[model samples]
Target: MALYKTIGAFLLFLGTVSGYANPGACSGTCVNTHDPSIIRRSDGTYFRFSTGGKIAVHTAPDITGPWTYKGAALPAGSSIDLGGNQDLWAPEVALVGNTYYLYYSVSKFGVQDSAIGVATSSSLDVGTWKDLGSTGIRSSSGKPYNAIDPNLINADGTYYITFGSFWKDIHQVAMKNPPKAVASGSSAVQVAFDPVKTDEEGAFVFKHGSYYYLFFSKGKCCGYDTSRPAAGEEYKILVCRSTSATGGYKDKSGKACTNGGGTVVLESHGNVYGPGGQGVYDDPVHGPVSIRSRKTIWLIMLIIFALQILYYHYVNTKIGFADGQKQFGWNTINFSSGWPVV
Candidate 1:
């Protein structure tokens, strides 16, 4: 009877093994890329953007693609140089009506002197981009504030820009038209999560199921030895939701985001430091989804294996080995030594 029971368990294990495949396949780590932005066209093509003030086009029939890069959307000489500009970073792309707008920032890392600018393109295919110039948003010294990363979202026929970094606070500016300048007297307001000292950038806001979701990345970004690899140094993507676009956003634990409460939507799986610059797009195959580069899924799988091993030892010690042998649990394995494990 015991042998029969063991055979049955073995059969079940085989069935599970046959049904379960690897977690997912992702190329090892696409290096030299950070602050990724994605846009899906009506024709089922995807265009992605990064910090260098350039946009790259990738086409795929599905969202999870063998995404092939066509070319850069912004031309070589299209970069902007604001007062004492350093480098262009953190590009956010939005589509409204028939036009596509690319919002980007110019700043030195760790400096509040940053400026955000816009560029418009009627067709995202190849040529057709026109730089709409800067919005005159700057810091007190006539220099740019880190608070200038622009994230555009339209609500109720009116467009709103959520722009800010860690220096001051995240602010919202309303626009009468989509992808245009803010309305007169539309001063910025402190909204969503605020970081006391850490730099909070890449603020992306969207509406889902009557709830306005605020997604932001906080912590250090874009430096090799810049404390990102250490614990708490890792950048994480956090999320909060509210009924209104401006206030009452709360985490899953029901803590208000205004009080610095946030639920982590995504985090670095492994060597994927600062996997924060995110964008959402509508795919013909997967409906609405987000695309951002990170460490490959293989790293996540290794962590899962390590956790399973630790759990197996913990279960064997807590519960008697013989009793554990008969217990049904996830991914259980029975060894010849009468030890049952996961």
Candidate 2:
């Protein structure tokens, strides 16, 4: 009982420092998402698509989910010729007209040999997809910009996509009507680049009131097993905003996003590590929602719970331990400051 009290106190301290008790979003199977892009059905069900195994799909009845794995959005892999890995990375889902378009990335680890492909589905279910082929976007050996992590946006009906990494960070291109393809002869523009860190990608844009917010991830991701990661290497979510969707994004400190300016939205805290690869969805109930991936604290709790079970059985045990009750609750984080409290 004393050990449990200490653990609870430590968690409370961490939450006080981080300005959040727990993320008010969904958990359980709903929490295991990476580069997540979420969309809502007509029946109020939320479908979440993410990076992995040809684009994994999860669905839930509410935004706060008891998410269940459905299947891959793209089962056969990408039609793009530059593929070295069939496992898609960073899926962005958008509803255009009556159809849903899924944009995914194909790359060879850290190399610039990458392409963004699209697949269309009339319904968000398994085996209902048709690959729309590549968006004619690619990053070659000598190109300054990467052509992965595609995010489609509509600026007053004109479609555009923002994508890139490493070499020149984030770039935007004018997209054609259906948005599965780039506009003919439309030049890609350099939007957001980090001159200092040079480690920005997973760009997602959301328009709220008077500004278009550009959210990107910086530093290394997917290195969870490392003994102790450095501050700069751990994945964290950052944001900048622009009046126009095209350019001139700045952080809260009035620094240019091109010159390595970004305000941290979410970062590693306690057992929740490497939070990045985010997407924004406008919820009918919760208003605006941000989704991402992080190794959560509950895994650590489970391990501790198992150890407690062993301690109670074989070691010094608590009296009437079986009579102890556990309760779980939720507390929503306020995002009026343009970021989740953390």
Which candidate achieves the best TM-score against the true structure?
A: 2
Q: Give TM per candidate.
A: 0.69, 0.79
| Model 1 vs. true fold: TM | 0.69
| Residue 307, candidate 2: alpha-carbon lDDT | 14
Q: List the residue pairs that clash in candidate 1.
A: 114-144
CA deviation > 4 Å runs, candidate 1: 1-30, 53-61, 76-86, 140-145, 193-195, 225-229, 270-272, 288-342
Steric clash pairs (candidate 2): none
Q: Count the backbone clashes (under 3 Å) in each candidate.
A: 1, 0
List, residue by residue over 152-172, the lDDT tens digit for candidate 2. Answer: 989999999999988989999
lDDT of 2 at 24: 50
Which prediction has the highest lDDT against the true structure? 2
lDDT of 2: 0.70
Question: Per-residue lDDT for 113-149 in model 1, tens only?
Answer: 5666777888766567676656545544432235466
- lDDT per model vs. reference: 0.54, 0.70
